[model samples]
Target: MPYDVEKPDEQWRAELSPSEYAVLRQAATEPAFTGEYTDTRTEGVYSCRACGAELFTSGTKFESHCGWPSFYDPKDTDAVELVEDRSHGMVRTEVRCARCGSHLGHVFEGEGYPTPTDQRYCINSISLRLQPTDG
Candidate 1:
């Protein structure tokens, strides 16, 4: 799919670090429980690390104890794109930044989390840039 912030592979590689490119461009998953945002509770907006597009907010973040950071919803309905993922012998919803089409992570549902959407957006920390709000 075409993205609003389309760039050549060479440019993306030059812009993002090795690990960031691996997750954002190559759809690689970071090791669970090792992400920076896994236990972060700061109030802020989490933007896509690759394109600076706001994808989530601290208000929607919740502790699902799922290792990675979890959000009940995106900042806006169109802020992300969910695609059916059938890799690694399983089916799941893969989340990507709508603006840049960079991989954020996967979203899960029906696990009985007491959230308004009943969905868990398990995102990678390296895929996000948290902008903490001033008190």
Candidate 2:
């Protein structure tokens, strides 16, 4: 369970804002439709807000109407780590930044989404830092 960018809780809290710490460190979900990246369509790469690790690209983003930003895939397979989550009366897959082990969000699959992966990486905007591509 050790991460490449391991830091003490105090350090993490010092670096992240209150909202970012809740979602990224404590795995709390932000209110639906409130995330900054929910409706963003600009070309960019989304990196981990806590660790600066590239996680997803705009090309893989889709409108899932699920209130959060949805990506069909990670920037790379190794960019994220998926773990089985059995909380809140449901079984789901939790996605985290591979480098820092900060929670990104849950990933759901096989719900008939019209995407190559048919999967939705439902991530919180507070968990990401978007770096827009230069045109």
Candidate 3:
């Protein structure tokens, strides 16, 4: 899914914080562990607080200890878009919301974790909201 008509600057300002605007709208990343969801382990789907798009599930989370919220996979395959991130001094895959294009984080392969999926999705804490399911 692609982003729809953008909200006006005034409306965006009223809805989002400076950092939220920078990351969620402008595609910036907050520093590790400083975000709201890095240490969260609620039993729910993590959705886009801005648009309610399901991005992650609590089940895939692991204590990566990488200072950011880490996941092995997304809750839905269509929830995100991955692009080649050639920024900084390394090559990484930049992860974003497929619907709203929110800056989620980076995905790296082959970290040698003990899991079957040797992938680490180091994500921004501010980009997600825990919506616990009625189990």
lDDT for each candidate structure: 0.98, 0.97, 0.81
Question: Residue 4 in model 2: shift from native, Å?
Answer: 1.0
Query: Candidate 2, residues 15-78: lDDT per residue as tens digits?
Result: 9999999999999999999999999999999999999999999999999999999999999999
Per-residue error for 27 in candidate 2, Å, reads 0.2
Model 3 lDDT tens row, 18-113: 887787877688887687788887778888756678988999988888888889999888788898887788988998888777778888879887
Write one digit per residue (lDDT tens) for candidate 1, span 38-116. 9999999999999999999999999999899999999999999999999999999999999999999999999999999
Off by over 4 Å in 3: 4-10
Candidate 1 Cα RMSD after full superposition onto the native fold (Å): 0.6
Residue 13, candidate 3: how far off, in angstroms? 3.4
Which residue pairs in candidate 2 have backbone atoms (N, alpha carbon, C) closer than 3 angstroms, thus clashing? none
Better of 2 and 3 by lDDT: 2
Backbone clashes, each candidate: 0, 0, 0
Model 3 weakest lDDT span, ten residues long: 1-10
